[model samples]
Target: MPDFSKLYDDLKRARDEIKLKIHLGSKDAQDEWAELERRWATFENKAELERSAKDVSDAVKILGSELKDAFQRVRKAL
Candidate 1:
């Protein structure tokens, strides 16, 4: 699974950074941020299992990648 702890930490850092800037972004970005937050929660739960099992599920990988990309888009929007 390539040590998803690193991936989780990196994503958490990015998400935190964006959260501080989101207030200054547009309504659309804020809405997207909200949706991403939901996904993040879902990811967090599955990520732990995957991290522990050392077996990366396709769903978690896709969701994590999606969150990363979405966070980048929101940051650019901001």
Candidate 2:
């Protein structure tokens, strides 16, 4: 089982940084940020960002991947 602590930590940090950058970003980024925030609560709970892959459900792993990609897109937008 792969450890996701680092993956989660990196993305979470990026998420925070992007949040601050949102004010300087466009309306589209803001809208995406809102949606990401909504989804983030659920993602955060399901993904403590420390548990191993075997400890987490496949659904969560998938969500994490999605969030990673979504966050990257948001970063590009900013």
Cα lDDT computed for each candidate against the true fold: 0.90, 0.82
Which residue pairs in candidate 1 have backbone atoms (N, alpha carbon, C) closer than 3 angstroms, thus clashing? none
lDDT of 1: 0.90
- Give the TM-score comparing model 2 with the true structure, all chains together: 0.56
Clashing pairs in 2: none
List candidate 2 segments past 4 Å from native. 49-78
Please give, for residues 1-78, the per-residue lDDT of candidate 1 as tens digits. Answer: 455778999999999999999999999999999999999999999987776665446668888999999999999999
Best by TM-score: 1
Model 1 RMSD in angstroms: 21.1
Candidate 2 at residue 33, lDDT? Answer: 90
In model 1, where is the ten-residue run with the lowest total lDDT?
50-59
Q: Candidate 1: where is the Cα deviation over 4 Å?
A: 52-78
